[model samples]
Target: MTKPNLLPRSSDMASETSAEFSWPPLESNPEVFTEYLYQLGLPSDWFVGEVFGLDDDSLGFVPRPAVAVIVTFESLKKETDAVAAAKVDFFMKQSPKLDYACGVIACIHSVLNSLDSITLVENSILEKYYRATKTQSPADRATTLENMTEFQEVHTSYASLGQSSVPTAEDDVKHHFVTFVQNALGQLIELDGLKKGPVVVNAASSDILKDTAAVIQARIEAGVYSDSLAVLTLAKVADDIDAAVQALIDSSNGVLEVTSVENKDGAKVSRIKCTATGHEMPPRADIVTAHVNSKRFKKATEWYSYDFAQFEPYIVSHRRKPKCLFCNVTGIVLNKIPSEVEKHMQGRKFVRMKEHVKFFDEAEIDKDD
Candidate 1:
């Protein structure tokens, strides 16, 4: 649907730019788009993922209730009659929403038009752009985009994430992006900055992604693009993982704590711990799940304190993980406990290490280094 989220067109608005600017082409990658959007205030619960194909089977792989579908296709030369070509109408007439930032444009088009599914983060660079240009013309919006340093900086940063050689400002990029989003009325609408206006891809739709796939498939059959095209969709991938983890912490009843500490590699890591027991482990729901549902921990302390205490000199912590000195010296996993210690102690390697007094402590090595 034509929303005021983009620049409002005007009769006398200037379209001329004193200086030209071009955005680097972005790769049609879901991971890259997902990360890029995340940096731009896309809610953590939502993510962009690659659409394997336009066929029904392939589209089925996408998360259900797909909010929008974007295509990376060739931006062909503007035909003299392209605007009037294959024109179709709906119950009413038309209305709205630029740049090598065709990728950025498509990203913006898909997001702003799909407000029902996406709420741009408050005060985010994208939100500022949406608010600033809702009443400007496409040309004016282009000029605004070129001048918005913060937003332009973000676009430029992600442009380099493209898989191929980064295109320079002077280079002509071949790949272009377009978005297909369903308006409020469930009508399939096409948003291309290069187009005269929003093109209604379909009059009606039960499923946005499925209908989008049909439209793209039709375009493919008509030989619209010379090269293979890539498709990506925005969807609700999962519950916000961080939020889930936070909820877990809130309900942990002082049994669990998540702390950020730098490891030997100098990377910040969230180390999960059982505060009451002074035990630490990775921050994963399934680990918490298995413990609550299983009896494995019923004798856990006894396993460590009573039976495993004899190997105290052989125990050490590495990379925030408690490991058997004998095992790390031998290159292995996984954890501490007396039964496991006894099992490894019977090994010939353990016997050899014990016989000659050959012992190694990675924790000590790291400290020395």
Candidate 2:
């Protein structure tokens, strides 16, 4: 328009400046192109710089097109921070052929790799933190989660029994079954992690028969027990209880084995064996019954009551040191008592006397007072 100016326009001038600083064409030599990008602030880790020279064809014709080499470098970093820098290097290799779509796919792949690295690092951090603060064993934590989930399911299933106008024997059996299964599963999970062995659910506890059947059914669904796994029932081995054994066999597809044992009431107990073998075995129960009971009832009775007919001597020997029982105990120690030995056992501490005495006289009391 008014005799077009020979001088370049502003856009053309800007383009010339950009062209001067532009990355070298990859067709000339990919290494030169990569180095140019690196000089332009591209990260060193973005591309693999190894040179694989041209290959030979038939009759030793060395004419294989130079192939760009890519090597992976992994670093733990936030996904958002790494994507943009990764994308620039990826597109540089593809720009000569105008393979924009390929370049985009490569960038996306890099982003996914970065995200996966972050996720793995996060899980590892959580695992380390959990070990640092948690007092429970790793097996305990794993079993706790397993038990809690199972307990919640059972609790939800039994809630309807609460509102029933007439509670029947069937309901009682079901409730007992639920409790038995919950306990058994908890024990099994713990044992599974510790023993690294299969939990052989000894069906000797008649209270657990119905529950065992339900457990077997559930395990079948979870793939813990299958047709190959052994399921032994005492009923099957005994002539009088074959029907009970058959009932369980009919309920599950697992292999059945039976044995007999005497029940608490003098009746023969039917034992069903659900042996979990191999790496697939579930955990065993935490069999801390006697220890747990001792801890639970320790503080309920005074020092005299603790020196029972069976354990009196041991108690005396343990308390002779004028030890601070509470501090030594597995439980929290509140105060130090010079005479009685206080120690934590299974989250509870107990104070037991060094020697039994009928009474504290006025002189002893007066000295302390």
> Best TM-score goes to which candidate?
1
TM-score, each model?
0.57, 0.13
Q: Which pairs of residues collide in candidate 1?
A: 8-135, 8-136
Query: Candidate 1 at residue 347, lDDT?
Result: 81
Q: How accurate is candidate 2 locally (lDDT)?
A: 0.27
Output the number of the lDDT-best candidate.
Answer: 1
Q: How do the residues 1-369 of candidate 2 rate in per-residue lDDT, one tens digit apiece?
A: 589544322233233233222111122222333333233222323321221221122112111111121211111221222211111111112222112112122222232223212221222322232322244443333322222322223223332332443333233221100011112222211011112222334323333333344454555566544422222111111223334345544543442234455533365544444321101100111111111134422333233234322323223233433322223222233322223332321222233432232445689999998
Question: How many collisions between residues are there in candidate 1?
Answer: 2
lDDT: worst 10-residue window of model 1: 88-97
Error of 2 at 124 (Å): 33
